[model samples]
Target: MHICFICDEYPPAPHGGSGSSYRDLSEGLVAQGHQVTVVGVYKNPQWHGGKGVDETINGVRVVRLPSSPSWLRYKLQTLSDRLKISRWLKCEHQKNPFDIIEASDYGGWLRFGGPAGVPTIVRIRGSNYFFDVELKRNGDPFEHKIEEAALARADFIGSVSRYASERTLDICKLSHRSCTVIHNAVDMDLFSPSPGVSRERGLIVFVNSINPKKGIEQLIDAMNVVCAKFPEAKLAVIGQDTQKPVDGITYVEKLKQRMKPEFLDRVIFTGRMDRYKGVLDYLRRAHICCYPSHMETFGIAAIEAMSIGKPTIFSETGPGPEVIEHGVSGLLCNPHDALDLADKIVAILSSDELAERLGTNARCRVETLFNKKHWVQRNVEFYERCISSNSHENGRCGCK
Candidate 1:
């Protein structure tokens, strides 16, 4: 089967959960003897060489398109990208056709609809509406309408988690649309535990964009408490420091201002690192991995850490519960409650027995359920179903 993915954040370039998830699925499908093409529209030409650039990475063909002139307004840029993406799909379909086209619900890139007869699936990797609601902010009305139109036009819809799907429906008031839940997965081969790699005794690794949404502030607050309890307890923050500077001070500096001076010395910030080399090495070295995000369609970062057999602490809010079975697989913390997060961290740091048990169980959970091979196969089945259903409908139309 030929599968085409419309993604903005494809890897080798900087990306988030959605792009990484699509990459895993795309590569897995290629390995299974399926043709996979990724159509990515970039806002910045620097992200991909100019425009209409084509390359094959790990057997999957990738086509990159520049959305619009960078100088244009944000809305205008998005509108242009939507039209270009639609045109690309139509032209590509005319040439060889795609069995199924899957797009992220991130920016409603398919608001104009996809190829003339292709079955399109808009996988909910969180939408603007969903994010606004989660973060308690008012989003642009135009974006919400565009996203709703995109979802409404999809032949089928899949979500990374039930929470994300349900919240999207409620937020969009899509009474008729039903979403199938398919959790995001990680590459176990690349993220597996290396028992020989000695773990840093009191090291806790936090991997994600250093923003308020990721509960970094809360994690910092918790670290203060955790450090006091275990003198050696330290945190190594790994990811992009996205926080904008305020009043001539950087966001990291602002965070430091609130920290206890003694505890401050232990925390280290390694801004944005390569996933394969930097992030993986840190995860392998850490005794514990924490992703206390306030929102996640599906917490892939936490799962990545868990897959590495490091005891993980995921947020109780959002889809963390679905990913981790509380005390069984990994620990869950109230992301908003600093004290609770601290206690959870302290519990894992204080007992090596519990950490090992949780870490072992966490690895088992990922291997058993969230395995990339397993989920990629599931995606193939789902795409086949969508394709067959579309064909049947077309047949009925011809008969009529």
Candidate 2:
């Protein structure tokens, strides 16, 4: 089967869950004897080679389209971007028609309805509408219209978690649309526990963008409480701040200001590390990983930590409860409650036996359910189903 992905983020261009997961899926599908092509947009074309560049990375063919700075002319820029992406996909389709075209829902790709008769599947990765609702922002009316149109036109839709799917429906009022929930998978071999990296005692790691939606402020507050009990406890923050500076202060600086001087010294910020190398290394070295996000599609960071056999704590909301058994595989805490998070942190820190048990259980759970191989297989089945359904509806196989 031939699969083509349209997304704005891909490795070496920008880092995010959608890009990383799509990369993993593409490579895994290729390994399984399926042909894959990816068409992605780069925010800064100059950072990467000038503009349109087609290359194969890790056996998957990738085409990178340069996007004009959207901030300068938001509406015009995105409209131009959509047209360019559509044209590229149509040209590629002429060469070797795709069996299925899967696009990330982030950039409103579904609005164009994809290449002619191709079965376009929009995989939900939290759209602007979902983000605005989560952050309590009054989003642009135009953006909401674009997202709703895309959702309506998409032949099929899939999301990393049921929570995300439900949220998208609630926001778009697409109660008639059927959304498939497929959890993100991790590369176990790459994230497996390493004896080479020495684990730091009483160390906690939080990996996500430095923003309020990620609940970083709440994590800091919880850390203050944790430090009151264990002075030596440390929190290492990883990931970039995509938000603009608040009140002339950077998000990182704001977090530092909120922390007590003594507790501040115990925290380390490694702002946006290389996902494969720096991120895995940090997870391997940490004693515990915490993802107290106020909103999440699937909590890929938490799953990556779990893959490394590190006991993780996630917010009780969203997909956390669904992914973890709470006290069996991992621990869960209320996203808005610092006291609850602090207590969970202390419990894991004080009991080495409990930590080990949770970590071991987490590793087992990932291996059985969240491994890359299983993810690719499920996607293959989904693609086949979509293709068969579309063909039946059209009275012929559309693929050339």
- Choose the strongest candidate by TM-score: 1
- Write model 2 residue lDDT over 1-400, tens digit each, in one string: 9999986677867668888888899999999999999887677765347767788999999888777666758888877777777787788889999888888777687576666778888888888888888768898878877777777678888888888898888888887789888889999999999878888998999998888888888899999999999867999999898778978988798889988887889998998898878988889999899999987878888889999999999988877887888999999999899899999999999999999999999999998888886898999999999889888886224321
Q: How far does residue 216 in candidate 2 sit from its true spot (Å)?
A: 0.7
The true-versus-predicted C-alpha distance at residue 236 of model 1, in Å, is 0.4
Off by over 4 Å in 1: 395-400
Error of 2 at 112 (Å): 0.8
lDDT of 1 by residue, 290-399 (tens): 98899989989998998999999999888888999999999999999999999999999889999999999999999998888789888888888888988888622221
TM-score to native of every candidate shown: 0.96, 0.94
Question: What are the candidates' C-alpha RMSDs?
Answer: 2.2, 2.4
Clashing pairs in 2: none
> Candidate 1: worst 10 consecutive residues by lDDT?
391-400
